[model samples]
Target chain A: MDEPEFIAALRSLPLHPGARNLEDDCALITIGNETLVINHEMMAEGTHFRPDADMADVAWKLVASNISDLAAKGAEPVGVLLGHSLGRDDARFLQGLKEALLAFNVPLLGGDTVTATGASTFAMTAIGRATHHPVPARRGAKLGDAVYVTGTIGRAMLGFEGAAHHRAAFDRPEPRLAEGLALAPLVSAIMDVSDGLLLDCWRMAKLNNQTFAIDPDAVPVADNARRDECMRWGDDYELLFTAAPGAAIPVAASRIGKVVAAGFAPLVLGKNAFPTADNLGYSHG
Target chain B: MDEPEFIAALRSLPLHPGARNLEDDCALITIGNETLVINHEMMAEGTHFRPDADMADVAWKLVASNISDLAAKGAEPVGVLLGHSLGRDDARFLQGLKEALLAFNVPLLGGDTVTATGASTFAMTAIGRATHHPVPARRGAKLGDAVYVTGTIGRAMLGFEGAAHHRAAFDRPEPRLAEGLALAPLVSAIMDVSDGLLLDCWRMAKLNNQTFAIDPDAVPVADNARRDECMRWGDDYELLFTAAPGAAIPVAASRIGKVVAAGFAPLVLGKNAFPTADNLGYSHG
Candidate 1:
């Protein structure tokens, strides 16, 4: 079975009410008066990074990606548990992990370490406390809401292409935690843009049973000349959200689209309707 | 770096107080009036199991092992997040996962599924709510406390050696959740016997600055003829705990030893004094 098939099978199992039907990036678990947001992410060698890539960057990226999921829920990180596979340059991995933990202001909780043959795979479970009630979700995008995205979408794509000036954007993507917190209360829907802006928008619109009418020119792109590639290229950890047209966003973001009632497609870019998500962004098998 | 060195390096990083200095099997995060016990465990192909192992058993074992850690803390499992690597027999894996979830009465929270090359690696994060204040810890064993173990040891070991009657012990080891809950208020210290009874005893003694003087004959083993092997073979998933001598123990467990003051060694099995943990049980690299 593939990822989609396996996930579908997983949905058939006993699921917690907080799972959000496994549709959201993070799980919201309530205990006592606090609601915790938890996210688990895995990065496999050769799948997430090059075999020759720096282990430090791999560790940093793993932590950042998981944190980005928590950010989408406007959660204040509590701690993280790491599942480490011991391999080459483990010291570098530790260094990067320390740096990431310090940078994100999250402490290490507890984890397991093991030795495995072949390519290394690292996993992390990030836990955070929700800062807003009725946590933002991808399925809450209301019709007529303005779609917005924080920061440029193509910096990571440029960096991956060996752009020296944008290298950090790819190696050390910054999670929009602050922005997520600021917009959580105002936004009708929210999610992180990890799987390309257009694809993520399509996912959000589809989840909400709404249509996203996006103006291609309105999206902020790191490289204006390669706008299409920038829009389709993923790894840019930006916040994509929807809010009332004139709502004060309280964060620096560009309004790129408007949510409409279910129409011809989930996503509409100018005159082109993206009836399907094929070739829209990165997808794991 | 090896597991020990890697973990030592991790100690230099920011650690939450709930981490228990990374010496325990689980982290304790107190949110509002609730204290959550969280555990993360990973199993890699070849490292944790044979390549030909059934995917269903592998999935069940993964969930069981993580739940065992939570059980050691006298915590009731809330839910679990899985990090699944898509590979051979994924349908079987999902089947086993569903069975485990149903058997344990624990709901699936959320997780990430990724496509990976080489040997597959699976990870799980089990979260639970503490049932008692001052939750059990490995470092709380006091002098004169009696060391007890629930169920017989070496069952998994026998099962691994193709003992038909013990197959379930190895493939679907039951977490001592109910036993742990009953013993929590009475036990001075507790942990699951995952890394051999002797090695885990040494660990608990070392952590508590005490010594475990065990009576080999008093310990229950699945195969008395291979009692030594049983004590050294890990993956039992039985609860190992220390309680005040002659206390009203509510669980049916074998009292095998007594906690003593720091001495020549951390563990003493009859006439043998184990100064080091080498070869006592499974140690992940």
Candidate 2:
């Protein structure tokens, strides 16, 4: 079975009240008056990170990726539990871990470690408390809502396309925590652009039963040479959200599209529906 | 750096209050009136389980080991987030995962999955709610407290030794959840005996600043012929705790020793102090 099939099987079984159908980026459960946000992300050798990548950078990326999920929901991190499989050298990983924890001001609560044979896998589960009740979800986008992206999408795409080896985008994509927190109370829907803006926008529109009329000329790209590639490329780790048209956005972002009535497709380029085969963002098979 | 050195480095960083110096079994965080217990454990191929082991059993053991930690703290599992790396056969692993989830009656929350090459590693983070306030800890044993152990020791050890191939003992050792809930209010300190009883006892004593004077004759062994070996072996997921002398004991456990004042050694056999070279538990180097 594949990953999506495995998740579908789990959904059929008994899941907790916080599971969210395994669709959202984070699980939400109310312990008392506060709602706790939790997420688990796994990074594997050879697949998620380059085999020759530095262990420290890999460690940083692992933590950053999980935290980004919380940021999408506008939750403040409480702590994290790290499940680490030791690699060839652990000192560099430790250095990177310490740096990430310090940089984020998050604590390493507890975790277990084991040695691996072939490839190493690291897992991080970040626990956060919701800053806003009814945390924003991808399905809340409404008709006529304006779509916005926090940062340039094509930087990571360019980085992946041999421009400095994606050092700025893939190696250390920042979680828009502050922007997420600031936008949580104001936006109709919010999500992180990890798997590419165009794909993620399609996801939000499909899940919300709305059509996103995006103008390729309006969508911010790092380079105009490959606008389509940059729009479909992922790993940018920016915030993609929707607000009322002309609403004052608290964060610096580009107004890329508008939420329209459901049409033949969830996404379009200036009223022309984009093909599913090419319009969607990056997805792991 | 080694495991101990790696942990020590984490201690130097800015950690959350719940981190507990990475010494306790789980991270304890009280949200409002409830205490939520969290833990993350990673199991690897070759190091944690035999390469020839069944994928279903590997999945079962992964969940069981994590829930066992919650049992030690006298907490009931709330839910779990699984960080899975695709293995040799996913169907078998899913079957085991389903059986284990049903057996424990815990919910499956959201998590991430990734593909891996070579040997695979899987991790699980268990979230539990404390049934008893002032939840038990490894450092709560007091002088003159009676040390008790649940179930039988060295069963997993003998199974690991390939003697009789203790299938039930090693494959599905009970977590003693019921006994833990019954004894949580009465116990002074408690923890799961994943390692050998002797090594774990020494750890509890050293952490609590007390000494344990254990009688080998009183310690229960799976096989009397290998009593010494059993005391040094681990993988026995049983509850080992200390309680007030003569307090209404609610669980069936054999009293193996008594807590004493600080001495030259943390643990002793009868009147002689045990050597650390062999008495310590199985530690990752």
Candidate 3:
């Protein structure tokens, strides 16, 4: 089975109410007066990075990606547990892990390590404390809410192409933690843009039973000459949110679209309609 | 690097106080009036199981192993997040996961699924709530405390060798959750016996600055003739704990040894001395 089919099969098993029916990026567990947000993500050698890629970058990206999920939930990170496979450049992996932990100020909790014979796979679980009670979700968008995105899109794509100035965007993309925390209480809906902007818009709209009507010319891109490609490339780690038209955003973001009633498509970029998510962004099979 | 060396390097990174300096099986996160116990474990092809091994058993063991760590902490499991790599017999994996969740009465949280090239690796993060204050750790065994183990050892070893009656012991070993809960308030230290009885005993003794002296005749084993092999083979998933000799155990278990002042060796079996963990049990490296 493919990724979607496997996930669908998993849905049939017993699920926690906080799983958000397997629709959210993170899981919520409320104990006593605290609600913990947990997220787990994995990065494989060939699927996520090249076999010859720097192990340091792989380690950094692993932590960043999982923390990005907590950021989308508007949570304050507590710590992280790592599931590591020992292989070449382990010292580099340790260096990257240390840098990531220091950069994020999140301590290493505990995890397991094992010796494996083939391609390496690393996994991390990020635990965080919810900063907002009604933590923002992808399915909370309301009709007429304005869509917004932080930072610029396509920077990572440029970095992947060896663009000198954009290397950090690809090597060490920062999760928009502060932005998500600030927007959580105000936005009608919110999510992180790990996938392409157009694809993420499609996902959020589909989840909320609405349509995202985006102005093609309004999205902020790293290179205006390649704006279309920028909007379709992923790994930007920006926050995508929807809020009332007159609400104070309290962050630096560009207003690029508005939430509309359910239409024939979930996303509309100018006059083009994207009825499905295929070919819009990266997806593990 | 080897598993021990890699882990030793990890100790230099930022660590949560509840990580117990990476000497314990699980991490503790205290928030408000609640303390959360978290455990992460991984299973990989070739390293953890055979290439022709049943995926159903793999999935079951994955969940059972992680839950076993929580059991050692006397925590009530809240939920688990899975990190899965797509591979053959996924339906069988789902079947086993479903059965394990139902048997454990734990719900599935959110997790990520990825496609990888070779040697499938699966990871799980188990989150639980502490049922007792001062949650037990590997470093709490006190002098004069009696060392105990739940259930007979070597069952999994026999099952792995195709013993029909012991197949379930290897494939679907049950975590001693109830027994752990019962002993939490009374035991000075507790941990699951996953990496062989001798190795685990040595670990607990070293961590507590004490020594474990065991009488070979007093230990329980599934096969009397192969007692030595039984004590050295891993994957039992039973609880190994220490408590005052007079403390009410409230559970059925065998007294295998006693904790004494720091000795020349960390473990004493009959007249044999094991100064180091080497050759005592399973070590991933």
Candidate 4:
């Protein structure tokens, strides 16, 4: 579709009286004084999952991955849109899809389906309501705020390394919805750890113009093969959050470090941070 | 991401004030009297596009494909979210992505990027707003409504046959955004002809509980290819709409046939409806 054609068609629709940011991904549609915020995430075949992976797990993982993004912003789940590649259109696949959707309780609204030339892919867009307070953004962290995480990290990455239990952990890192919702009203800034702990922390710090200082020892470890490897290896979908030193938050959190206004780069134990030697998180170009 | 963990996080976000059904693929976010509808469609590599396809055209078609879906609904484009696979994050690739976004004039709302295990894929979620009147739906055709199409058909399929121009046409379709936007308020039912004339029309008929009869000769052809093959080949992506006779629609359309009380199967008026043929389109299991 031509961009103009799309815009023109959208403009032709009657403006919803309270819809704000109509042409943006996150819209603040107001009802009275409250705003509902929305965003979506998609996973593809051979890209997000292995073609030979378990179908039921694939469906479950797609939903989980997208919902994790919502959790980062403390947004409540409303529903989802699913686009399925025609490659995986068998009855067994459908059964798994149904199981995943039902398990999430996020009803399927509507979506398009097409045949794929090779490996199958699936996309899921998640919608949710924003809380009254500022929706937690990647830019909300402040100097002097302490950094914390909801659960142990590196398990998901470990799972990817052929450790069956760890692979399952990596495959299905639970969204910290409880922690996110609880912390939404308290945290300075928030984001989910999808890439690697060090990488995500670096990104969050850059977004907020702050530096993260991890004690290395304080960083929570999921299980043990190696703490540094876990931190650097990607796929740990946990919540990396920041709050005031004495915020008295009520989520299961382990203080990994603190946010500070010092050197530009993330630091570990008062030293410049690097994925090697300590953190083992993955990097994206 | 585990389904429960992901869903738990999503469920934690605050609810939108006007969302009637926020947890579905398509949701109604009411802003006062007006309600904005949102949906997302994701396409993948080896599924939607070849990994080594022209990056620029691939990106353009990705956006266009999702936008085409919105066009079919008579909904206007609002924004888009992209889930990109990090197979090869080269400068040229990023440039291609930027061009596609700029071409669509849709802002890059936040999206997730992850490295794929195999071929590259991209998932795009298009959020569109429905106009005051109900946007056309596949299930709205009546027993007597006439079926019509916008623009020439079958060029895309022909493109796949190594016809350079036809191939380009196949890869990049002129999404009938203008016609769809213009007809949304007027048409009873609307959809893009992504699959083919025979199959898509069949789908439309099935959705509306009516039988669609098409005079094969009356159907527009894009080239002098085999008549039967043209009817079954997929990837045309044109608007196949249905409306009452003489509805005074704004878009120029070619009349093909009419809707009738349910028929035993989708009917074709050529040599034989069945033709012992491949039907010219791709199929999903």
Candidate 5:
């Protein structure tokens, strides 16, 4: 509906516990002592994925990508709502979707579907449960805590270059749910490495009012091709987190760097944080 | 990215409550005490919307559509999550999205974003609360319950006929959030009117194991179309429900017909129920 109608509709809702009001009802998950709400993100063709990508991978990746967000927050994925275009509803596509849901353990609750007047578009809203473990908010890193990554980075980037055995990396990046769950109770703050390591690090730093200094040698690279390009390309789906210096990490986390009280914005040794602007993860309109 | 890797990535998720385990997650959100746990829906380009549609309206309609589902359950809208694709990150689009979030009074909690390989898509997961209400479900209509709908139907079908005013109806259909909330504690079973009247009614009947009969004359139609054509077209987004005989409806609900104990299939008042090989609702494959 138009803006007025939308406003009218929202105003019409009766307040529920924790909703406060319509404007605050973004995410509806119960996290820690509060509820986590969410909204919509639109994905467009030719940008979020390669047009020739396998239909099944497209469907699985779509669900996996969203579930990773909940994992980043250490929130347990509850259900998903989808806003899908018409072309992707064929039997093959649905088969892929079923596989993805089964694989991730996230259920398809309910949602709306419509036809398009142009290119296809897809969007989804995923809900999760927030528990006693810290919610791993973006703004909770401490000054002296060390920054760590749950798994290796750059594999997905290498796959983009057609490197041998790298195709799988690019096509399907793992969602660090276990690592997130294990780290949730320990990490000061956390986020997923969907964007390039350098860029995402900068984001965490800015959010925490801290800076990250990474030792290039210590950064885990899947292979040689990925060693360089992965620094620029994004979509690794690893967990980047910060923890206290003396803390014991539950997962097999690699020490990427140390969080400093103040420094040049999230640097990789002496270089600009991300080096590339246009290729900083994926952008949607 | 491919099927195997995609499956591996998805299989990596840890078990959670709503997920019910990573393998069988797509079940409809049905919680303890018969409480419908959540509402899910999807919006996609070229299927649910027009490319040239106003970004603000698109955002608003997206939220409205999902909320309407919760309203149908007579459940309180709790929060939402979004899945977005990256193609073009236009400032205007973000602005419109923010405006819709603010207008809807639902907070923009959290979501996932991925670059797409094809058209754009937007999906929403809206979790609602209905602890005390019997939580109107789709399969609750019984014999002799009156079939009814809140507001008009077939407007969206007619709205799709042209690129001007009619498109508005199609582009931005109002989600009767208030009407749904008002009726939540009242209806025997509830459902939103996304598919055409005949198709959705049939679905409701099937889900409830009852026969739903909608009088053709009682069906609502928009101004732009012929009677018969409109009858077949869906996208109305109204609330269709069944109530016990002599039960009073709070909103402007039209009395269509009654649920029958026998006659398992959904039927028109005078004609035989058409069992088409093809489903009548919009398919997103």
Candidate 6:
């Protein structure tokens, strides 16, 4: 089976009620009065990074990407359990791990470590406590709602362009934990843009049975001359959500689009509609 | 850093107060009155299994090992979150994953999956609720305690000897969950022997600051001719424990040893003493 087929097969297995059919970024489980949000992510040498990539940065990216999912749920991190395959540059990897844990102020829970050969892999599970009720999901957007995003788009793609000053954006993109927590109480729908804004917006719209109509002039970009490329490229680690018009936004973000009634296309780029969501986004795989 | 150094470096990082400095096999956390046992394990190609090995068994072994950790803690399986790196044989892996979850009665929470180029790796987090107070750890053995192990030892080693009858023992070793729950309240110390019985005994002795004197003649083996080799070989999933001399030895285990006061050696093989735990067992690295 391929990735899609494999995932579909897994959907048939017995799952906890909190799993949400494996559609959401974070799984929700209620223990006592608290709602726990959990996310797990894995990164590898050849697939997620170059063989010669800085081990520290690789570790940082692993932690940040998982944390971003928690941020999308507006959850505060409890700790992370790590599973590591022993290989080269362990010292460098540890350094990067320390930096990310300290930067996010999340504790490191115990996990197993085993020695392995060929193509080292790293995985981590981040557990968090939800700060708001009815914890935000990507399918909660309403018709005629305003669409917004945190910070600018395409910074990671710019970092990939070999600019010395732009490198950290790609190496150590910060998860918007604070903004997510702030936005959770106000927004109807929210998710992080791990994939490109266009693709993620399309996903949110499709799940909500609405259409995201983004204005090319209003959408923020890393470089105005390459606007289309910036909107389509991903890895910016920005929060994207929908709120009622004139609602108070607690974080510094840009209002770039509106949620319209369901249409033939899930996403409309300017006046023209994309044929499919898959055709508009960049996939590292 | 190697495995030991890598673990030491992780100690310096900021962790939750309950992380226990990575001492216990599973991280212990209390949510309200519920004590949670969490463990994550990763298996890979080449190092963990043969590149050509059956993908289904590989997935089975991964889930069983983590479940074994829960069993050691006298905890019932709550659910598991899986982190998988995409590669070949995805269908077989999912089939095995389904079987293991059904066998153990565990729910699949949620996890992340990424496509990777080489060396497919699988990681899982098993969460459970403790059934007994002061959950068992390796550091609870006491002086003059009688040592026992549930079921016979070294059967897995015999499985490696081309015996079709014994092959299943090596392929899918059952975790002693029920036996552990039955023995938890009465035993002074208890642990599942994943490594060789001798090495695990030494580790428990060292952690408790005592010495274990085991009679080689009383120790059960797969065969008399291969007794010595069987005692040294690992992958036997049996519970090893210590209790008051004749405190109704609960399970169908043999009484093989006694825990003594602090001594120069942590383990005594018949009359000869082994200086360190690492020297007595297997090292896959």
Per residue, candidate 4 scores C-alpha lDDT tens digits across A82-121 of 6665545344455555655665555655554554555565
Q: Given candidate 5, what's the lDDT at residue A95?
A: 62
Order the numbered candidates by TM-score, best leading. Answer: 1, 3, 6, 2, 4, 5
Tens-place lDDT digits, model 5, residues B1-285: 232233344334333344433222122344444444455556666655666766666666777777777667666655555555444333344555666555556554444455555445666666666643656667678788898987666677767777475676676666777787788776888888776777777767766766776677787666534655665677778888888888877888888888887563555444766444145554333
Q: What TM-score, computed on C-alpha atoms, does each candidate reach?
A: 0.99, 0.95, 0.99, 0.79, 0.77, 0.96
lDDT tens per residue, model 3, A60-157: 99999988888888999999999999985999999999999999889999999999888999999999999988888888888899999999999999
- Evaluated on CA atoms against the true complex, candidate 6 attains a DockQ of 0.72
Maximum-lDDT candidate: 1
Worst lDDT run of 10 residues, candidate 4 chain B, spans: B16-25
Q: What is the TM-score (0 to 1) of candidate 5?
A: 0.77
- lDDT per residue (tens digit) for residues B138-230 in model 2: 878989999899888889877766667676678766677888888889999999988788889998888888889999889889999988888
* lDDT score of residue A95 within candidate 3: 96
lDDT value, residue A9 of candidate 1: 86
- Which CAPRI tier for candidate 5? acceptable
Q: With candidate 3 superimposed using the best TM-score fit, by how many Å does residue A10's alpha carbon deviate from the native?
A: 1.3
Candidate 1 wrong stretches, greater than 4 Å: none
- Positional deviation of residue A32's Cα in model 4 after best superposition, in angstroms: 8.6
Tens-digit lDDT track of model 4 for B85-184: 5544434445555665555555554444455555565677776667646545676888788889877777887787778878767666656777877888
Candidate 2 structure lDDT: 0.84
Of candidates 3 and 2, the better by TM-score? 3
Of 4 and 6, the candidate ahead on TM-score is 6
How far out, in Å, is residue A86 in model 6? 1.6
**Model 5 C-alpha lDDT versus the unseen true structure:** 0.63
lDDT of 5 by residue, A64-162 (tens): 777777777676766765555555433454566677777777766544445554555666666666643435666678888888887777888777778
Docking class of 4: incorrect
Candidate 3 clash pair list: none
lDDT of 4 at A31: 46
